[model samples]
Target: MKYWNLKKINQSAFEKTGIVPRSMSKLFNRFKQELNPNAEVEALEEFKVAKYQTSTSIKYIIVLLITPILINQLSKISVLDPLVNHLWNKNSNYIFLNPSQEERAFADLQRFEEKLHFEILIGKLDALSAENVNNKMSNKALAIALEYSQESVNAIKNIIADFISIIIFVSIIITNKRQFSILKSFINELIYGLSDTAKAFLIILFTDIFVGFHSPHGWEIVIEAILRHFGLPESRDFIFIFISTFPVILDTIFKYWIFRYLNKISPSAVATYHNMNE
Candidate 1:
């Protein structure tokens, strides 16, 4: 029995449908063009025949909504913030000596800290606010408050990005009825890729949490030790930035590998999905 053959499954699809894939840029443009005001209604009509397809589209929508929530929660873990703050303090002697640069860097850091707090607040509000409450506050007052709030701006950007992703996902499904299996397989790969990425993230998070619980500032000490062993600069700022960003970078690379592996195993699935637009 063949245990795993995404390649064979994809090949069968191609042999059955004879579709050719389009270039990535062209496919992106096509999706952009498909997002007309009437696109939602049209997409619903297109998938009406395949009830499963419609259900899959809804699932994608739910994923889109949930993604930001997950990201917000992860950010609240503040894994990087302490590191960054510690580094800033360590470099303060040198940083303080250069008054001009110090002033600017400090200002920027303050702004960043404020932005982070705002994001945390927005995340809390989004997670908590299921029902729209009627406030007796005037529209002008609310507008003024939002205008001054950086988090409000960030919230809008997140919402816009989420909306666009949902549209693209729905459009892909609606436009490629003939290649539903290919599309479905492609989406499954994406879901799997993200799952793997999340798993890696959780491992790191739990490890950090465990270390933190056992020893205060354990991550910093460990990172500093590693840097010292390597004869590298063990400045708090450098280590902070490195530890804070490295996980995200590593997660991205892992996700890319997952995608590439999926494509390697099922080239025809990707090709069919890509060419379905053509």
Candidate 2:
């Protein structure tokens, strides 16, 4: 039997369409376990399982939080930063991932030029020829180049650090298989054990954030941020396509899970969700 199916018997009373004989058998078994003389032993075993789940969960969280930051700092101190900068700086086009970055660079230079003009207008500086303006713009362009190079190097560091973190994350989950199973079961129980009203509220909240009408706008912003973080081109077409298709697919899968699993496991919660949604 599946490990998560262990709670099936306990929730048999909540089943709206079960055979009488099977229901009686489940009741008898529940009564036997509750009235058993080894109740203390059972309680102690459950406590041990919960302890393992807690420790494993904490380890997971710590690894996720610490590993990437540690790796990033170490890379900056090591040869990683110099090597990436050398390779990246060799290509002039690599300085900016997309035209938006170039536009922002020019905008900053324009602002600096405007400030210089304002200073001259207030008689705070001597009048400048066109050559002086060109020279200042050239210096600003060089500064922008150095800044973009640093950004690209940081993006490379982020990619390496995140990849290593994920490897460690998977290794931990694999090594602590039993504890992972316990944690998974514990989370499932916690969610499914919520009161019907609480369940309905959570369902609405999650759906609104992830699959609601406004979610596409949020998704667009997130996609743009992720692309910019990795020094990738921010393509509007790609963002729009993903926002259109991915959320629809996610919504469909969510509905399928509710119908196939949640409906069978807790029909009352499903009913509550429907009523609240309407």
Candidate 3:
């Protein structure tokens, strides 16, 4: 009596209908298995680490394009302008002259006093009232204070822009890392395991699913849901801040899970792939 071969029978079916049917069956099986926490964890551990190792030159280019926009938007915050102006006013000095002519006269006297006492006086004069000494100090102090205020405002704006840029840069990195992980998993199961002809056919299907789900527009809904959950205000600054920083938070959590759990099951594979180049 001849024994039947199950593997041969499956190969025959795969040959007859092509890899599409087999791939579809495998896809569904994987999907079902992924529904289980244990199976999902195991699958993540087995995920192809090599596929994700590549240059991030394109990612850096993307960051360069995006960081400027984030900085520009952050610089436009209304609060910054008012804070700068208010600080400028508070830190600046101004003489309170009663009449317009007296103000002009005080200005002339200030110039004369500065020219005459250039070598003698070491400090500025405060509150140059008509009855007070014409010590040219008020004008010098006002000029110095105004200069300092301008410098301080510019410094603050630069600091804030730099901070926002850093946040945006980190967010972009995290987003790219997550995308690489997804691509690796898809390639491992769908492309690496298939014949060349099967890979060609399935690549179209995979590309459609990957592009559709990974579009930035899809993130808007998730961002909105999170904002509503936290009862955050819907102001422009709040919205922009969320748009800039939320991806970093979300991707960090995802990477944390993969490293924390997946690393335990496949220690060697995980260790070798980390800090991968480009």
Predicted structure with the largest lDDT when compared to the true one: 2
Quote model 1's TM-score.
Answer: 0.21
List, in order, the clash count of every candidate structure: 4, 0, 4
lDDT agreement with native, every candidate: 0.47, 0.73, 0.49
User: Candidate 1 regions off by >4 Å?
Assistant: 1-49, 93-278
Off by over 4 Å in 3: 1-59, 65-79, 87-137, 178-278
Q: Cα lDDT of model 1 overall? A: 0.47
The estimated TM-scores of all candidates read 0.21, 0.75, 0.28
As for TM-score, the candidate ahead, 1 or 3, is 3
| Higher-lDDT candidate of 1 and 3 | 3
**Rank by lDDT (best first):** 2, 3, 1
The window of 10 residues in a row where model 1 has the poorest summed lDDT is 128-137
- lDDT tens per residue, model 1, 28-139: 7668758778877655653443344446556665654575555544443343335434554465432222233334445655565465457658885342232322231233
Instruction: Answer with 1 or 2, whichever has the higher TM-score.
Output: 2
Q: Give the C-alpha miss distance for residue 66 in model 2, angstroms.
A: 3.5
